[model samples]
Target: MCQLLGMNCNTPTDILFSFEGFHRRGGLTDHHADGWGIAFFEGRGCRLFLDDKPSADSPVAALVRAYPIQSENVIAHIRKATVGPVGLANTHPFIREMWGQYWIFAHNGDLKDYHPAPGQYFRPVGSTDSEAAFCAIMENLRQRWDAPPPLHELWEEVQSLTESIRAHGIFNFMLSNGEFLFAHCSTHLHYIVRKAPFTTAHLLDEDVTVDFANVTKPDDRVAVIATQPLTDNEHWTRIEPQQLILFKDGQPLYCS
Candidate 1:
């Protein structure tokens, strides 16, 4: 299986510190080294980077590690290659245009026999069940509404669709559209919110540390969600199994 990393902040923020630990799982700290990619959402536009190489060894990954691109919503993934070949098109987080926004998706689990009916509007560029699943979601949305639906309705629809997909196999994933960040936990997931009076954090996978007090102001608020905890010091809240969470403005919006 692959892994997921997501960030939702009240203000534009760079994910270099969290990404440093998360990227290592692509080849160094863990074995999900097929390929990797990330998308950073800034206003209505997004900066997406994909590499069909192990993130630990890819020069492009090195550049990203050094660059300080800032955004309010971000989604990233490191693949283990269960459904598609190790190539650029197969890498995630995959991006699509919908309702005048760039929708980003990243999956952390494998599905079995998940072929959806062919459609003219939504189709997969890569032969991965993950991409197929993304297309299916978009197609369903497009068929039901011409514009972005209400957040509550969208959450219900997404939860229902995710539940259907989980019946096939594990369906843990992260999704975002520059407005809201949605995360579903089929097995393992955790998150932490950093706000005023933030403290230092030590990366569990790398020999790096960051003191939030030195870099952030008194009003900055940020949320980091991942398949696993990235830091050792912060008390991350573990997501309950089979739960769907939507995050916006650094806070969680749960479906009722």
Candidate 2:
């Protein structure tokens, strides 16, 4: 299986700290080393990076760790390649254009016999079932509405589609369109929120800690979601199986 990481914040925030520990799982601290990719949403545009090499050793990943690119929403994945060949096109955190926005998606699980019907507008460029599922979701959304719906309505439709897909196998995933982040837990997922009066958080995979309060304003808020807890000190809430959550302004707006 792959691993997932996502960030949503009330203000633009860099993910260097969390990513430091998360990327270690790609080869150094764990075994999900087939490939890696990440996307950061800034306004209407998105910055995407991908590599078919282990994130722990890739120069691209090193650049990302060194650069503090701030974003309101971000998605990242480190793959173990359960379904597709190890290549650039098979990397997670795939991106697509829809409703005048670039949507990013990343999956952390495998699906069995999960070929979807032919899509009319969207299609997968990769061989992974994860990419197929992303395309299917886009196609379904396009067919269901002429334009993007309200956040709540969109969540309902997406939740229903994900439920239908989960019947085939695991479907843990994260999605974002610059404005909001939607996370679905088919098996394993966890999240943590940081706000005013923030305290120090120690990374579980690295020998480092950050006191967010010193770097953030009083009004800043941030939410981080991952396949597992990333910090050793802060409490991380586990997202239940089959649960879907929508996050905005660094807090969960809805859950089902």
Candidate 3:
């Protein structure tokens, strides 16, 4: 299994503090260490970085740790390689284009003996079931509608596809198109939101601490979702299995 990290904010925000701890799970503090990748959505464009090397020590990962790339939506993954060969080609956090927007996806669980129907619209560039699953969803979305559907409509369709895939095994995943961030939990998943009257938080994997009040505006709000809680002091909410959440502007959009 892999680990996933996602951030959705009302305004552009850097994920440096959170990523610093999360990336260590790729090799140092934990043992996910196969390959890693991250994508940050800035306006209509996205900045992405990937490496086959262990994220804890990859030179590219070092550079990412040095820079504070700001974005409104971001998704990242650290892989453990259950189905595919450990190489750059099989990395998670795969990207594709849809509805004239870039879509990023990252999975955190493995499916058992999964093989989706052959698709005429989208295909996977890698051999992992994770990639195949992503393609399946994208293909379905493309075939179901010519343009991006309404958020609630899209959510229902995605929720169905997500459940179908989860039938084979775990289907925890995060997806974003620079507009909405969708997270579906089939196994373990947790999230926390920070807003005005922010407090200090200490990373569970590191001794580092950050006081949000010192750096963020009063109106700033951020929602972070992960396979596990990244900070020990935060009140992280565990997302129930089979639940799908649609997030925007740093909060979950509840659909009635």
Query: How much does each candidate deviate from the true structure in C-alpha RMSD?
Result: 1.0, 0.7, 1.1
RMSD of 1: 1.0
Candidate 2 lDDT tens digits, 131-177: 99999999999999888898778999999999989998998999999
TM-score of each candidate structure, all chains considered together: 0.97, 0.99, 0.97
Q: Residues 1-256, candidate 3, lDDT per residue (tens digit)?
A: 6899999999999999999899999899888779899999999999889999989989988988899998999999999999889987789788999889999999988899899877888888889999999999999999999998888888889988887898988889999999889998988989999999999999999999999999899999999999999999889999999898988999999521
Q: Is candidate 2 or candidate 3 better by TM-score?
A: 2
> Which ranges of candidate 2 are over 4 A from the true structure?
none
RMSD of 2: 0.7
Tens digits of lDDT, candidate 1, 1-256 = 6889999999999999999999999899899779999999999999999998999998888988999998999999999999888899899998999888899999988899899987667899999988988998888888888998888889989988888888888888988999889999989889999998889999999889999999897988899999999999899999887899999998797742
Clash pairs (backbone) in predicted model 3: none
The number of the candidate with the highest lDDT is 2
Residue pairs with clashing backbones, model 2: none
Model 1 CA deviation exceeding 4 Å by range: none
| Better model by lDDT: candidate 1 vs candidate 3 | 3
Note the Cα lDDT for every prediction shown.
Answer: 0.90, 0.94, 0.91
Q: Which candidate is the best by TM-score?
A: 2
Between candidates 1 and 2, the one scoring higher on lDDT is: 2
